[model samples]
Target: MGDDQDIGYAVTAEFYDLLQAETDRRQARRRFAEPAARARQAILDVGAGTGIVTGILLTASAVPVHAVEPSAPMRAALLTRLAALGADQRARVTLHPEPIEETGLVRAVDLAIASNVVATLPPPVRRATWQAVARALTPGGVLLFDPPPETLPGGRETAARLGPVRVGPDLYSAELTLEPERGILRSVFTYRVERDGVLQREEREAFDLWPVEPALLRAELEAAGLHVVQAPHADLVAARRTAS
Candidate 1:
């Protein structure tokens, strides 16, 4: 979502929204809605790709949001979506075009959400991110992200593939081939957009993803002054800022 991982997202960002099901989006909305409602100060969205999850946070609560997105294309799309919001909502969002470290951080945020961006974070970046998240959050502030299930290294032929969404006259598909090497999941994403049973456009891009150990992740957060807590949902990992 930032300078560390934009290379793989270039091609994928175009068809990102298309690949997600309506049910998936709705479920995601419901999952974060509670924290958004409870947030009094503000919410932070790290790697806010195309603002799908960010929009959910905005609509779920009447509070300001810090949308940190480093990918230009995705950020542009995010800006496009934010442009359609009512003036009040529009005024509440501050777009950070850089990584969390380089941005003007707010230390009183009530919640921070990182959707699909967590597992892909390299160890070095993840450490920096956890430290930054700790610094930005208010006491008892919440941080929720995916409990990324580890994937074994595999070739495209044997890798897990998802999508092939039908969109009126066209169809979209994405294949994720993971190569976990050098402490990163080198993901080769193959995207194919076709129409009327004809292959139209195909793109392949490599995304670097780093594995996360829950125990280690917990230790890291604790070191950063945050505590892993019971998640609102069974699928997410929730951490709260311990009172200083």
Candidate 2:
């Protein structure tokens, strides 16, 4: 995660699960179930926010998982989520509080996954992150992820929506701005907490996302000695480490 994304997640962490909802979990599980089921050994989950996909991977298999998350608040939530699982399931996971590029993981994994995470990284960090992921994988290991489309409308101001979600005593809303020239999406999220129908507190956070082009991403993966393939899921890409 970039600094901006970290800030955004920190502010919204309290209500992140509410925003994601059960439907989001179901869809993610459907998308990742096959790959998770195929894992015969260790797996790594990059930017494993709130442990949604991490939980899915655990459910699919008892493989050991290393979950890397950058934001402190998100990691807190992830830990809480993991604690709710069975002891065996919880024991299978190891949490790292570092971004993918900087995570000091010495063990090679059989599979690695990053879901909706690469797009939020700055260019230099994004490339370095991919290289780190490649380094973490064993030869012939697979990497699966979805990068945002390059064709997203560039210069647009999306309408802001207020109170689109109500999570317990809090309400959430977001405003988005897209700058195609910079390949960045800027977002401002608002959180309002109320008690007894009285507003008690309100907070706002900003995030910047840089979505990489598919062609450029493919080139980077190849440069890292991985063979890339477009996965069945829309916008999803799978890359395999080539034998040295």
Query: lDDT per prediction?
Result: 0.81, 0.77
| Model 1 local distance difference test score | 0.81
TM-scores, all candidates, are 0.90, 0.86
**Error in Å for residue 152 of model 2:** 5.6
Clash totals in order:
1, 0
Error of 2 at 36 (Å): 0.7
Question: Highest TM-score among the candidates is held by which one?
Answer: 1
At residue 98, what lDDT does model 1 achieve? 88
Estimate, for each residue in 1-244, the C-alpha lDDT of model 1 and write its tens digit: 3463553467777877778646546876878988898889999998887888888889998899999988887888889889988888989999988888777575859899988777777677787888888888998898999865465455333365667888889888988777767656676878898999899999998867677667888998899898999999988899999999
lDDT of 2 by residue, 15-54 (tens): 6787664665897788788888888888999989889989
After best superposition, candidate 1 residue 213: deviation in angstroms?
A: 1.8
